[model samples]
Target: MRARTAAERVACPVCGTASVRVHSRYVRRLADSAFRGCPALIDLRVRRFRCAQQDCAQATFAEQVDGLTFRHGRRGAGMQAVLDRVAVMAAGRAGSHLGQVLAAKVSRSTLLRLIRRLKGPERVTPRVLGVDEFAPRKGHIGAETGFCTGQRNR
Candidate 1:
Protein backbone atom coordinates (compact mmCIF):
# COMPACT_ATOMS: atom_id res chain seq x y z
CA MET A 1 0.00 0.00 0.00
CA ARG A 2 2.64 2.51 1.11
CA ALA A 3 6.37 2.48 0.35
CA ARG A 4 9.43 4.74 0.31
CA THR A 5 12.84 4.88 -1.32
CA ALA A 6 15.46 2.88 0.62
CA ALA A 7 18.47 4.47 -1.05
CA GLU A 8 20.32 7.24 0.82
CA ARG A 9 21.35 8.90 -2.43
CA VAL A 10 20.44 8.84 -6.10
CA ALA A 11 22.53 9.61 -9.17
CA CYS A 12 21.74 12.66 -11.28
CA PRO A 13 20.83 11.85 -14.88
CA VAL A 14 22.62 14.81 -16.46
CA CYS A 15 26.09 14.89 -14.81
CA GLY A 16 26.03 11.53 -12.99
CA THR A 17 26.33 12.98 -9.52
CA ALA A 18 25.46 10.83 -6.51
CA SER A 19 23.35 13.35 -4.60
CA VAL A 20 22.67 12.71 -0.91
CA ARG A 21 20.80 15.97 -0.27
CA VAL A 22 17.03 15.49 -0.07
CA HIS A 23 14.83 17.79 -2.15
CA SER A 24 11.27 16.42 -1.79
CA ARG A 25 9.07 13.33 -1.82
CA TYR A 26 6.18 12.25 -4.03
CA VAL A 27 3.68 9.37 -4.01
CA ARG A 28 3.32 7.42 -7.24
CA ARG A 29 0.21 5.27 -7.48
CA LEU A 30 0.83 2.22 -9.65
CA ALA A 31 -1.79 -0.22 -10.93
CA ASP A 32 -0.49 -3.63 -10.02
CA SER A 33 -1.71 -7.20 -10.56
CA ALA A 34 -5.04 -8.33 -9.15
CA PHE A 35 -5.34 -9.90 -5.69
CA ARG A 36 -8.09 -12.51 -5.38
CA GLY A 37 -9.91 -11.25 -8.49
CA CYS A 38 -9.56 -7.64 -7.40
CA PRO A 39 -7.26 -5.09 -8.98
CA ALA A 40 -4.18 -4.58 -6.79
CA LEU A 41 -2.57 -1.21 -6.21
CA ILE A 42 0.69 0.22 -4.89
CA ASP A 43 1.36 3.64 -3.44
CA LEU A 44 5.07 4.10 -3.74
CA ARG A 45 6.59 7.03 -1.94
CA VAL A 46 9.71 8.17 -3.79
CA ARG A 47 12.26 10.83 -2.91
CA ARG A 48 13.82 13.57 -5.01
CA PHE A 49 17.50 14.18 -4.39
CA ARG A 50 19.36 17.41 -5.11
CA CYS A 51 22.10 17.28 -7.76
CA ALA A 52 25.58 17.44 -6.18
CA GLN A 53 27.28 18.63 -9.35
CA GLN A 54 27.07 22.41 -9.66
CA ASP A 55 27.29 22.34 -13.47
CA CYS A 56 24.48 19.76 -13.79
CA ALA A 57 21.40 21.18 -15.48
CA GLN A 58 19.02 18.98 -13.45
CA ALA A 59 18.36 20.46 -10.03
CA THR A 60 16.84 17.28 -8.66
CA PHE A 61 16.08 13.70 -9.69
CA ALA A 62 13.83 10.94 -8.45
CA GLU A 63 15.01 7.53 -7.25
CA GLN A 64 13.87 4.47 -9.21
CA VAL A 65 13.42 0.92 -7.92
CA ASP A 66 14.86 -1.64 -10.28
CA GLY A 67 12.29 -4.08 -11.82
CA LEU A 68 9.49 -2.32 -9.95
CA THR A 69 8.40 0.53 -12.17
CA PHE A 70 9.53 3.24 -14.58
CA ARG A 71 9.16 7.04 -14.70
CA HIS A 72 5.69 8.30 -15.78
CA GLY A 73 4.39 4.72 -15.86
CA ARG A 74 1.15 4.12 -13.95
CA ARG A 75 1.07 0.32 -14.29
CA GLY A 76 3.34 -2.11 -12.44
CA ALA A 77 5.45 -4.78 -14.12
CA GLY A 78 3.07 -7.63 -13.30
CA MET A 79 0.03 -5.80 -14.63
CA GLN A 80 1.90 -4.91 -17.82
CA ALA A 81 2.98 -8.50 -18.38
CA VAL A 82 -0.61 -9.81 -18.26
CA LEU A 83 -1.91 -7.09 -20.55
CA ASP A 84 0.87 -7.73 -23.05
CA ARG A 85 0.10 -11.45 -23.22
CA VAL A 86 -3.64 -10.83 -23.58
CA ALA A 87 -3.06 -8.32 -26.38
CA VAL A 88 -0.85 -10.74 -28.28
CA MET A 89 -3.25 -13.67 -27.91
CA ALA A 90 -6.33 -11.81 -29.17
CA ALA A 91 -7.04 -8.71 -31.20
CA GLY A 92 -8.22 -5.41 -29.64
CA ARG A 93 -11.95 -5.96 -28.97
CA ALA A 94 -11.59 -9.66 -28.28
CA GLY A 95 -8.68 -9.16 -25.94
CA SER A 96 -10.52 -6.40 -24.12
CA HIS A 97 -13.45 -8.72 -23.46
CA LEU A 98 -11.10 -11.43 -22.36
CA GLY A 99 -9.39 -8.97 -20.01
CA GLN A 100 -12.74 -8.11 -18.39
CA VAL A 101 -13.66 -11.80 -18.05
CA LEU A 102 -10.39 -12.37 -16.25
CA ALA A 103 -11.08 -9.26 -14.09
CA ALA A 104 -8.16 -7.37 -15.63
CA LYS A 105 -10.70 -4.76 -16.89
CA VAL A 106 -8.80 -3.16 -19.77
CA SER A 107 -10.49 -1.16 -22.55
CA ARG A 108 -10.38 -2.17 -26.19
CA SER A 109 -8.38 0.92 -27.08
CA THR A 110 -5.95 0.24 -24.24
CA LEU A 111 -5.44 -3.33 -25.41
CA LEU A 112 -4.86 -2.05 -28.95
CA ARG A 113 -2.47 0.55 -27.64
CA LEU A 114 -0.52 -2.02 -25.64
CA ILE A 115 -0.32 -4.34 -28.66
CA ARG A 116 0.89 -1.49 -30.87
CA ARG A 117 3.63 -0.62 -28.38
CA LEU A 118 5.33 -3.98 -28.90
CA LYS A 119 8.11 -3.97 -31.47
CA GLY A 120 7.71 -6.10 -34.59
CA PRO A 121 10.13 -8.88 -35.60
CA GLU A 122 13.55 -7.74 -36.77
CA ARG A 123 14.20 -7.97 -40.53
CA VAL A 124 17.48 -9.52 -41.65
CA THR A 125 18.99 -10.41 -45.04
CA PRO A 126 19.87 -14.09 -45.33
CA ARG A 127 23.46 -15.02 -46.15
CA VAL A 128 22.36 -18.16 -48.03
CA LEU A 129 19.14 -18.72 -49.99
CA GLY A 130 17.42 -21.78 -51.51
CA VAL A 131 14.47 -22.28 -53.86
CA ASP A 132 12.13 -25.24 -54.27
CA GLU A 133 11.66 -26.91 -57.66
CA PHE A 134 8.13 -27.91 -58.80
CA ALA A 135 7.29 -30.86 -61.08
CA PRO A 136 5.66 -29.63 -64.29
CA ARG A 137 5.50 -33.10 -65.83
CA LYS A 138 7.02 -35.90 -63.83
CA GLY A 139 7.14 -38.55 -66.62
CA HIS A 140 8.63 -36.27 -69.29
CA ILE A 141 12.02 -37.55 -70.54
CA GLY A 142 13.77 -34.50 -72.02
CA ALA A 143 12.15 -31.89 -69.77
CA GLU A 144 13.46 -33.46 -66.58
CA THR A 145 14.73 -30.44 -64.61
CA GLY A 146 11.25 -28.78 -64.52
CA PHE A 147 11.53 -24.94 -64.64
CA CYS A 148 14.68 -23.77 -62.90
CA THR A 149 16.90 -20.72 -63.42
CA GLY A 150 20.48 -21.78 -64.37
CA GLN A 151 22.96 -21.85 -67.22
CA ARG A 152 21.70 -24.12 -70.07
CA ASN A 153 24.01 -25.97 -72.46
CA ARG A 154 22.43 -26.47 -75.92
Candidate 2:
Protein backbone atom coordinates (compact mmCIF):
# COMPACT_ATOMS: atom_id res chain seq x y z
CA MET A 1 0.00 0.00 0.00
CA ARG A 2 1.14 3.58 -0.70
CA ALA A 3 1.66 6.01 2.16
CA ARG A 4 1.95 9.80 2.37
CA THR A 5 3.81 11.87 4.94
CA ALA A 6 2.07 14.22 7.36
CA ALA A 7 5.01 16.62 7.26
CA GLU A 8 4.47 19.82 5.27
CA ARG A 9 8.07 21.05 5.21
CA VAL A 10 11.65 19.80 5.37
CA ALA A 11 14.98 21.45 6.07
CA CYS A 12 17.64 21.66 3.41
CA PRO A 13 20.63 19.45 4.14
CA VAL A 14 23.26 21.86 2.89
CA CYS A 15 21.90 25.21 4.09
CA GLY A 16 19.52 24.15 6.88
CA THR A 17 16.70 26.25 5.45
CA ALA A 18 13.12 25.10 6.01
CA SER A 19 11.47 24.72 2.62
CA VAL A 20 7.75 24.20 2.01
CA ARG A 21 7.69 24.89 -1.73
CA VAL A 22 7.05 21.62 -3.51
CA HIS A 23 9.02 21.14 -6.69
CA SER A 24 7.74 17.66 -7.35
CA ARG A 25 6.53 14.41 -5.81
CA TYR A 26 7.23 10.79 -6.54
CA VAL A 27 6.57 7.31 -5.19
CA ARG A 28 9.77 5.91 -3.76
CA ARG A 29 9.79 2.13 -3.78
CA LEU A 30 11.60 0.62 -0.80
CA ALA A 31 12.14 -2.93 0.36
CA ASP A 32 11.10 -3.37 3.94
CA SER A 33 11.83 -6.25 6.32
CA ALA A 34 10.19 -9.59 5.63
CA PHE A 35 6.90 -10.31 7.37
CA ARG A 36 5.94 -13.83 8.34
CA GLY A 37 8.45 -15.18 5.80
CA CYS A 38 7.16 -12.82 3.12
CA PRO A 39 8.84 -9.76 1.66
CA ALA A 40 7.26 -6.30 1.98
CA LEU A 41 7.41 -3.08 -0.02
CA ILE A 42 6.97 0.56 0.95
CA ASP A 43 5.60 2.93 -1.66
CA LEU A 44 6.42 6.17 0.06
CA ARG A 45 5.16 9.48 -1.24
CA VAL A 46 8.32 11.54 -1.28
CA ARG A 47 8.27 15.25 -2.01
CA ARG A 48 11.05 17.35 -3.51
CA PHE A 49 11.44 20.82 -2.02
CA ARG A 50 13.09 23.74 -3.76
CA CYS A 51 15.81 25.30 -1.63
CA ALA A 52 15.18 28.99 -0.90
CA GLN A 53 18.63 29.70 0.48
CA GLN A 54 20.43 31.90 -2.03
CA ASP A 55 23.85 30.52 -1.07
CA CYS A 56 22.76 26.89 -0.92
CA ALA A 57 24.50 24.77 -3.54
CA GLN A 58 21.68 22.24 -3.76
CA ALA A 59 18.62 23.38 -5.69
CA THR A 60 16.28 20.55 -4.76
CA PHE A 61 16.18 17.90 -2.06
CA ALA A 62 13.85 14.99 -1.47
CA GLU A 63 12.30 14.27 1.90
CA GLN A 64 13.90 11.42 3.77
CA VAL A 65 12.21 9.27 6.43
CA ASP A 66 14.76 9.23 9.21
CA GLY A 67 15.63 5.78 10.65
CA LEU A 68 13.35 4.27 8.02
CA THR A 69 15.33 4.71 4.81
CA PHE A 70 17.97 6.72 2.96
CA ARG A 71 18.18 8.53 -0.37
CA HIS A 72 18.32 6.10 -3.30
CA GLY A 73 18.62 3.14 -0.93
CA ARG A 74 16.59 0.08 -1.87
CA ARG A 75 16.30 -1.56 1.56
CA GLY A 76 14.95 -0.26 4.82
CA ALA A 77 17.34 0.80 7.57
CA GLY A 78 16.50 -2.18 9.79
CA MET A 79 17.15 -4.70 7.03
CA GLN A 80 20.32 -2.91 6.05
CA ALA A 81 21.45 -3.02 9.66
CA VAL A 82 20.87 -6.76 9.77
CA LEU A 83 22.86 -7.20 6.54
CA ASP A 84 25.73 -5.19 7.99
CA ARG A 85 25.80 -7.36 11.09
CA VAL A 86 25.79 -10.49 8.99
CA ALA A 87 28.58 -9.16 6.79
CA VAL A 88 30.72 -8.52 9.85
CA MET A 89 29.90 -11.83 11.51
CA ALA A 90 31.10 -14.15 8.76
CA ALA A 91 32.92 -14.34 5.43
CA GLY A 92 31.14 -13.64 2.14
CA ARG A 93 29.70 -17.08 1.46
CA ALA A 94 28.94 -17.76 5.09
CA GLY A 95 27.43 -14.35 5.63
CA SER A 96 25.25 -14.72 2.56
CA HIS A 97 23.94 -18.04 3.85
CA LEU A 98 23.22 -16.50 7.24
CA GLY A 99 21.45 -13.54 5.64
CA GLN A 100 19.23 -15.89 3.64
CA VAL A 101 18.14 -17.62 6.82
CA LEU A 102 17.59 -14.26 8.50
CA ALA A 103 15.36 -13.14 5.61
CA ALA A 104 17.78 -10.55 4.27
CA LYS A 105 18.59 -12.67 1.22
CA VAL A 106 21.81 -11.07 0.04
CA SER A 107 24.28 -12.61 -2.37
CA ARG A 108 27.83 -13.73 -1.55
CA SER A 109 29.52 -11.15 -3.75
CA THR A 110 27.37 -8.37 -2.37
CA LEU A 111 28.14 -9.45 1.18
CA LEU A 112 31.87 -9.49 0.44
CA ARG A 113 31.71 -6.08 -1.21
CA LEU A 114 29.88 -4.62 1.76
CA ILE A 115 32.47 -6.03 4.13
CA ARG A 116 35.28 -4.61 2.00
CA ARG A 117 33.70 -1.15 1.95
CA LEU A 118 33.62 -0.88 5.75
CA LYS A 119 36.37 1.07 7.51
CA GLY A 120 39.49 -0.95 8.24
CA PRO A 121 41.66 -1.23 11.36
CA GLU A 122 43.06 1.89 12.96
CA ARG A 123 46.34 3.35 11.77
CA VAL A 124 49.51 2.15 13.51
CA THR A 125 53.25 2.18 12.78
CA PRO A 126 54.61 -1.30 12.07
CA ARG A 127 57.57 -2.39 14.22
CA VAL A 128 58.62 -5.38 12.16
CA LEU A 129 57.49 -7.43 9.19
CA GLY A 130 58.47 -11.07 8.46
CA VAL A 131 58.94 -12.37 4.96
CA ASP A 132 59.87 -15.54 3.01
CA GLU A 133 62.34 -14.71 0.23
CA PHE A 134 62.07 -16.17 -3.28
CA ALA A 135 64.10 -15.98 -6.52
CA PRO A 136 63.25 -12.99 -8.69
CA ARG A 137 61.84 -13.71 -12.13
CA LYS A 138 63.72 -13.38 -15.53
CA GLY A 139 67.28 -14.23 -14.28
CA HIS A 140 67.93 -10.50 -14.91
CA ILE A 141 67.63 -10.04 -11.16
CA GLY A 142 71.25 -8.84 -10.66
CA ALA A 143 72.27 -8.23 -14.29
CA GLU A 144 72.08 -4.86 -16.00
CA THR A 145 69.81 -4.59 -19.08
CA GLY A 146 72.84 -3.54 -21.14
CA PHE A 147 74.49 -6.96 -20.60
CA CYS A 148 73.14 -10.54 -20.84
CA THR A 149 73.59 -13.20 -18.13
CA GLY A 150 76.43 -15.81 -18.19
CA GLN A 151 78.19 -15.70 -21.66
CA ARG A 152 76.91 -15.20 -25.19
CA ASN A 153 77.98 -17.29 -28.19
CA ARG A 154 80.03 -15.41 -30.79
Candidate 3:
Protein backbone atom coordinates (compact mmCIF):
# COMPACT_ATOMS: atom_id res chain seq x y z
CA MET A 1 0.00 0.00 0.00
CA ARG A 2 1.14 3.52 -0.83
CA ALA A 3 2.00 5.68 2.18
CA ARG A 4 0.30 9.08 2.27
CA THR A 5 0.84 12.24 4.32
CA ALA A 6 -2.53 12.07 6.06
CA ALA A 7 -2.07 8.39 6.86
CA GLU A 8 1.30 9.17 8.41
CA ARG A 9 -0.07 11.91 10.66
CA VAL A 10 -0.39 9.70 13.70
CA ALA A 11 -0.78 11.96 16.71
CA CYS A 12 2.53 12.94 18.26
CA PRO A 13 2.32 12.03 21.92
CA VAL A 14 4.73 14.79 23.02
CA CYS A 15 2.89 17.64 21.27
CA GLY A 16 -0.52 16.09 20.62
CA THR A 17 -0.25 17.51 17.14
CA ALA A 18 -1.64 15.69 14.13
CA SER A 19 0.00 18.04 11.66
CA VAL A 20 3.17 16.07 11.13
CA ARG A 21 5.18 16.56 7.93
CA VAL A 22 7.50 14.05 6.37
CA HIS A 23 11.13 14.69 7.23
CA SER A 24 12.56 11.46 5.83
CA ARG A 25 11.54 8.06 4.61
CA TYR A 26 12.71 4.48 5.12
CA VAL A 27 11.65 0.87 4.73
CA ARG A 28 10.80 -1.38 7.65
CA ARG A 29 11.26 -5.16 7.46
CA LEU A 30 8.45 -6.99 9.21
CA ALA A 31 7.43 -10.62 9.55
CA ASP A 32 4.09 -12.10 8.57
CA SER A 33 2.58 -15.53 8.36
CA ALA A 34 3.03 -17.19 5.01
CA PHE A 35 0.09 -18.95 3.35
CA ARG A 36 1.96 -22.18 2.69
CA GLY A 37 2.68 -23.14 6.29
CA CYS A 38 5.81 -20.99 6.43
CA PRO A 39 6.66 -17.45 7.48
CA ALA A 40 7.03 -14.40 5.23
CA LEU A 41 8.24 -10.83 5.29
CA ILE A 42 6.38 -7.59 4.77
CA ASP A 43 8.39 -4.54 3.91
CA LEU A 44 6.73 -1.46 5.33
CA ARG A 45 7.75 2.00 4.20
CA VAL A 46 8.19 4.15 7.27
CA ARG A 47 8.43 7.91 7.43
CA ARG A 48 10.18 10.16 9.88
CA PHE A 49 8.37 13.42 10.41
CA ARG A 50 8.65 16.77 12.14
CA CYS A 51 5.90 17.64 14.58
CA ALA A 52 3.90 20.65 13.40
CA GLN A 53 3.81 22.41 16.76
CA GLN A 54 6.36 25.15 17.37
CA ASP A 55 6.86 24.37 21.06
CA CYS A 56 7.41 20.67 20.64
CA ALA A 57 10.68 19.35 22.07
CA GLN A 58 11.07 16.56 19.55
CA ALA A 59 12.99 17.80 16.55
CA THR A 60 11.99 14.83 14.42
CA PHE A 61 10.30 11.58 15.29
CA ALA A 62 9.95 8.43 13.25
CA GLU A 63 6.47 7.19 12.49
CA GLN A 64 5.30 4.30 14.60
CA VAL A 65 2.83 1.79 13.18
CA ASP A 66 0.48 0.07 15.51
CA GLY A 67 1.69 -3.40 16.62
CA LEU A 68 5.28 -2.71 15.60
CA THR A 69 8.50 -1.67 17.28
CA PHE A 70 11.57 -0.08 15.58
CA ARG A 71 10.90 1.30 12.11
CA HIS A 72 12.98 -1.39 10.43
CA GLY A 73 12.86 -3.94 13.16
CA ARG A 74 13.68 -7.30 11.53
CA ARG A 75 10.80 -9.23 13.00
CA GLY A 76 7.27 -8.28 14.01
CA ALA A 77 6.23 -8.53 17.66
CA GLY A 78 4.41 -11.87 17.41
CA MET A 79 7.11 -13.49 15.31
CA GLN A 80 9.76 -12.07 17.60
CA ALA A 81 7.98 -13.61 20.55
CA VAL A 82 7.98 -17.02 18.89
CA LEU A 83 11.67 -16.70 18.08
CA ASP A 84 12.34 -15.69 21.66
CA ARG A 85 10.62 -18.76 23.08
CA VAL A 86 12.51 -21.03 20.71
CA ALA A 87 15.76 -19.22 21.52
CA VAL A 88 15.37 -19.68 25.27
CA MET A 89 14.74 -23.37 24.82
CA ALA A 90 17.31 -24.15 22.10
CA ALA A 91 19.49 -21.05 22.35
CA GLY A 92 20.89 -19.95 18.96
CA ARG A 93 20.98 -23.19 16.99
CA ALA A 94 17.34 -24.07 17.30
CA GLY A 95 16.17 -20.52 16.76
CA SER A 96 18.25 -20.20 13.59
CA HIS A 97 16.91 -23.48 12.26
CA LEU A 98 13.36 -22.38 12.90
CA GLY A 99 13.96 -19.03 11.27
CA GLN A 100 15.31 -20.68 8.17
CA VAL A 101 12.28 -22.93 7.83
CA LEU A 102 9.87 -20.11 8.48
CA ALA A 103 11.73 -17.85 6.02
CA ALA A 104 12.05 -15.26 8.77
CA LYS A 105 15.44 -14.03 7.39
CA VAL A 106 17.20 -14.33 10.74
CA SER A 107 20.64 -15.75 11.39
CA ARG A 108 21.93 -17.63 14.39
CA SER A 109 23.64 -14.55 15.69
CA THR A 110 20.60 -12.45 14.87
CA LEU A 111 18.41 -14.84 16.79
CA LEU A 112 20.79 -14.63 19.73
CA ARG A 113 20.79 -10.86 19.51
CA LEU A 114 17.00 -10.82 19.53
CA ILE A 115 16.95 -13.20 22.48
CA ARG A 116 19.39 -11.01 24.38
CA ARG A 117 17.44 -7.85 23.61
CA LEU A 118 14.12 -9.39 24.57
CA LYS A 119 15.38 -10.95 27.81
CA GLY A 120 17.06 -7.66 28.71
CA PRO A 121 18.77 -7.68 32.10
CA GLU A 122 17.76 -9.81 35.02
CA ARG A 123 18.29 -8.84 38.64
CA VAL A 124 19.99 -11.35 40.83
CA THR A 125 20.98 -11.12 44.48
CA PRO A 126 22.83 -13.43 46.91
CA ARG A 127 26.40 -14.52 46.46
CA VAL A 128 25.98 -17.58 44.30
CA LEU A 129 23.66 -19.76 42.22
CA GLY A 130 24.09 -23.49 42.25
CA VAL A 131 22.98 -26.59 40.38
CA ASP A 132 22.67 -29.98 42.00
CA GLU A 133 24.68 -32.75 40.41
CA PHE A 134 23.50 -35.81 42.33
CA ALA A 135 19.73 -35.66 42.13
CA PRO A 136 19.63 -35.08 38.38
CA ARG A 137 22.38 -37.58 37.72
CA LYS A 138 23.12 -39.91 40.61
CA GLY A 139 26.01 -41.79 39.02
CA HIS A 140 27.80 -38.70 37.70
CA ILE A 141 30.90 -37.68 39.62
CA GLY A 142 31.61 -34.03 40.57
CA ALA A 143 28.67 -32.82 38.49
CA GLU A 144 27.74 -30.09 40.97
CA THR A 145 28.18 -26.54 39.70
CA GLY A 146 27.81 -23.00 40.99
CA PHE A 147 28.09 -19.58 39.40
CA CYS A 148 29.67 -16.76 41.37
CA THR A 149 27.46 -13.71 41.31
CA GLY A 150 28.67 -10.18 40.42
CA GLN A 151 30.71 -11.46 37.51
CA ARG A 152 28.52 -9.49 35.12
CA ASN A 153 28.34 -6.29 37.20
CA ARG A 154 32.09 -5.92 37.35
Candidate 4:
Protein backbone atom coordinates (compact mmCIF):
# COMPACT_ATOMS: atom_id res chain seq x y z
CA MET A 1 0.00 0.00 0.00
CA ARG A 2 1.17 3.54 -0.76
CA ALA A 3 0.49 6.32 1.73
CA ARG A 4 1.64 9.75 2.80
CA THR A 5 1.79 11.39 6.21
CA ALA A 6 -0.97 13.95 6.77
CA ALA A 7 0.76 15.85 9.54
CA GLU A 8 1.05 19.58 8.77
CA ARG A 9 3.83 20.15 11.28
CA VAL A 10 6.09 17.91 13.36
CA ALA A 11 8.23 18.56 16.41
CA CYS A 12 11.99 18.25 16.09
CA PRO A 13 13.28 15.40 18.19
CA VAL A 14 16.19 17.38 19.59
CA CYS A 15 14.77 20.92 20.10
CA GLY A 16 11.05 20.04 20.32
CA THR A 17 10.26 22.89 17.94
CA ALA A 18 7.43 22.26 15.50
CA SER A 19 8.70 22.61 11.95
CA VAL A 20 6.57 23.11 8.84
CA ARG A 21 9.39 23.71 6.39
CA VAL A 22 9.92 20.70 4.16
CA HIS A 23 13.53 19.87 3.45
CA SER A 24 12.82 16.82 1.29
CA ARG A 25 10.64 13.77 0.95
CA TYR A 26 11.43 10.07 0.92
CA VAL A 27 9.68 6.75 0.81
CA ARG A 28 10.08 4.38 3.77
CA ARG A 29 9.22 0.78 3.09
CA LEU A 30 7.79 -0.85 6.18
CA ALA A 31 6.85 -4.45 6.73
CA ASP A 32 3.39 -4.61 8.25
CA SER A 33 1.58 -7.48 9.93
CA ALA A 34 0.05 -10.14 7.69
CA PHE A 35 -3.32 -9.36 6.17
CA ARG A 36 -5.56 -12.31 5.40
CA GLY A 37 -2.63 -14.78 5.42
CA CYS A 38 -0.60 -12.58 3.05
CA PRO A 39 2.37 -10.40 3.89
CA ALA A 40 1.61 -6.66 3.88
CA LEU A 41 3.96 -3.86 2.91
CA ILE A 42 3.59 -0.12 3.30
CA ASP A 43 5.40 2.35 1.06
CA LEU A 44 5.05 5.44 3.16
CA ARG A 45 5.99 8.83 1.79
CA VAL A 46 7.33 10.94 4.64
CA ARG A 47 8.79 14.41 4.73
CA ARG A 48 12.09 15.67 6.11
CA PHE A 49 11.72 19.01 7.84
CA ARG A 50 14.34 21.68 8.46
CA CYS A 51 14.61 22.52 12.15
CA ALA A 52 13.34 26.03 12.93
CA GLN A 53 15.56 26.37 15.99
CA GLN A 54 18.79 28.12 15.03
CA ASP A 55 20.92 26.47 17.69
CA CYS A 56 19.40 23.01 17.41
CA ALA A 57 21.98 20.31 16.80
CA GLN A 58 19.79 18.64 14.20
CA ALA A 59 19.63 20.61 10.97
CA THR A 60 16.91 18.41 9.52
CA PHE A 61 14.86 15.50 10.80
CA ALA A 62 12.45 13.00 9.37
CA GLU A 63 8.85 13.09 10.54
CA GLN A 64 7.56 9.88 12.05
CA VAL A 65 3.95 8.81 12.17
CA ASP A 66 3.07 7.81 15.70
CA GLY A 67 2.39 4.07 16.14
CA LEU A 68 3.18 3.49 12.47
CA THR A 69 6.89 4.29 12.33
CA PHE A 70 9.99 4.72 14.49
CA ARG A 71 13.61 5.75 14.03
CA HIS A 72 15.54 3.27 11.83
CA GLY A 73 12.70 0.76 12.03
CA ARG A 74 11.89 -1.40 9.01
CA ARG A 75 8.77 -2.98 10.50
CA GLY A 76 5.59 -1.33 11.73
CA ALA A 77 5.15 -1.08 15.49
CA GLY A 78 2.32 -3.62 15.53
CA MET A 79 4.29 -6.15 13.46
CA GLN A 80 7.37 -5.59 15.62
CA ALA A 81 5.28 -6.21 18.74
CA VAL A 82 4.04 -9.51 17.31
CA LEU A 83 7.61 -10.56 16.44
CA ASP A 84 8.81 -9.59 19.90
CA ARG A 85 6.16 -11.75 21.52
CA VAL A 86 7.10 -14.69 19.28
CA ALA A 87 10.79 -14.20 20.07
CA VAL A 88 10.11 -14.19 23.80
CA MET A 89 7.87 -17.25 23.71
CA ALA A 90 9.82 -19.51 21.31
CA ALA A 91 13.26 -17.97 20.63
CA GLY A 92 15.78 -18.71 17.79
CA ARG A 93 14.86 -21.63 15.49
CA ALA A 94 11.47 -22.14 17.08
CA GLY A 95 10.68 -18.46 16.76
CA SER A 96 11.60 -18.46 13.09
CA HIS A 97 9.27 -21.37 12.49
CA LEU A 98 6.53 -19.63 14.40
CA GLY A 99 7.09 -16.45 12.41
CA GLN A 100 6.58 -18.38 9.17
CA VAL A 101 3.37 -19.90 10.48
CA LEU A 102 2.20 -16.40 11.39
CA ALA A 103 3.12 -15.11 7.87
CA ALA A 104 5.91 -12.88 9.16
CA LYS A 105 8.77 -15.12 7.85
CA VAL A 106 11.71 -13.81 9.87
CA SER A 107 15.06 -15.61 10.22
CA ARG A 108 16.26 -17.45 13.31
CA SER A 109 19.15 -15.02 13.73
CA THR A 110 16.73 -12.10 13.54
CA LEU A 111 14.58 -13.70 16.20
CA LEU A 112 17.64 -14.17 18.43
CA ARG A 113 18.59 -10.54 17.88
CA LEU A 114 15.08 -9.52 18.85
CA ILE A 115 15.39 -11.59 22.02
CA ARG A 116 18.66 -9.82 22.84
CA ARG A 117 17.03 -6.43 22.24
CA LEU A 118 14.22 -7.14 24.67
CA LYS A 119 14.49 -5.59 28.12
CA GLY A 120 14.64 -8.11 30.94
CA PRO A 121 11.83 -8.31 33.47
CA GLU A 122 12.20 -6.28 36.65
CA ARG A 123 13.91 -8.11 39.53
CA VAL A 124 12.00 -8.51 42.78
CA THR A 125 13.47 -9.73 46.05
CA PRO A 126 11.84 -12.85 47.47
CA ARG A 127 9.38 -12.12 50.25
CA VAL A 128 10.43 -15.15 52.31
CA LEU A 129 13.91 -16.58 52.83
CA GLY A 130 15.04 -20.07 53.76
CA VAL A 131 18.43 -21.29 54.98
CA ASP A 132 19.82 -24.68 56.09
CA GLU A 133 23.15 -26.13 57.16
CA PHE A 134 24.56 -29.00 55.15
CA ALA A 135 27.62 -31.17 54.70
CA PRO A 136 29.61 -30.58 51.50
CA ARG A 137 30.97 -34.10 51.26
CA LYS A 138 29.73 -37.32 52.81
CA GLY A 139 32.19 -39.17 55.15
CA HIS A 140 34.53 -36.16 55.14
CA ILE A 141 34.77 -34.67 58.64
CA GLY A 142 36.25 -31.30 57.57
CA ALA A 143 33.87 -30.76 54.59
CA GLU A 144 30.98 -28.68 55.92
CA THR A 145 28.84 -25.84 54.48
CA GLY A 146 26.87 -22.91 55.92
CA PHE A 147 24.25 -20.44 54.60
CA CYS A 148 23.03 -16.99 55.70
CA THR A 149 19.67 -15.31 55.10
CA GLY A 150 18.28 -11.86 55.94
CA GLN A 151 15.23 -9.68 55.40
CA ARG A 152 15.37 -7.01 52.68
CA ASN A 153 13.71 -3.58 52.69
CA ARG A 154 11.32 -2.80 49.91
Q: Give the best candidate by lDDT.
A: 4
TM-scores, all models, native as reference: 0.72, 0.73, 0.60, 0.80
Model 3 lDDT tens row, 6-83: 373666768878855788888776675454766666677777878888889976787776665544566666677677
Estimate, for each residue in 65-146, the C-alpha lDDT of model 2 and write its tens digit: 8988787788888887778778899858899888777777789998887788788999986677423122233343333443
Q: How badly does each model clash, as a count of residue pairs?
A: 0, 0, 0, 0
Instruction: Predict model 4's lDDT versus the native.
Output: 0.88
- Point out where model 1 deviates above 4 Å: 125-154
Instruction: For each candidate in turn, give its C-alpha RMSD to the true structure in angstroms.
Output: 6.1, 8.0, 9.0, 7.0
lDDT of 4 by residue, 25-143 (tens): 99999999999989999999999999999999999999999998999999999999999999999998988999998899899999999989999999988777544323343333332
- Candidate 1's displacement at residue 55, Å, is 3.1
- Each model's lDDT comes to 0.80, 0.78, 0.64, 0.88
Q: Rank the candidates by lDDT, best first.
A: 4, 1, 2, 3
Tens-digit lDDT track of model 1 for 24-143: 888999888888888778899998888999878898888888888877778888788888999999958999888877678888889888888999999988777644323233433233
What TM-score does candidate 3 get on C-alpha atoms?
Answer: 0.60
Task: Identify the candidate with maximal TM-score.
Answer: 4
Off by over 4 Å in 2: 121-154
Distance from true location, Cα of 111 in model 1, Å: 1.5
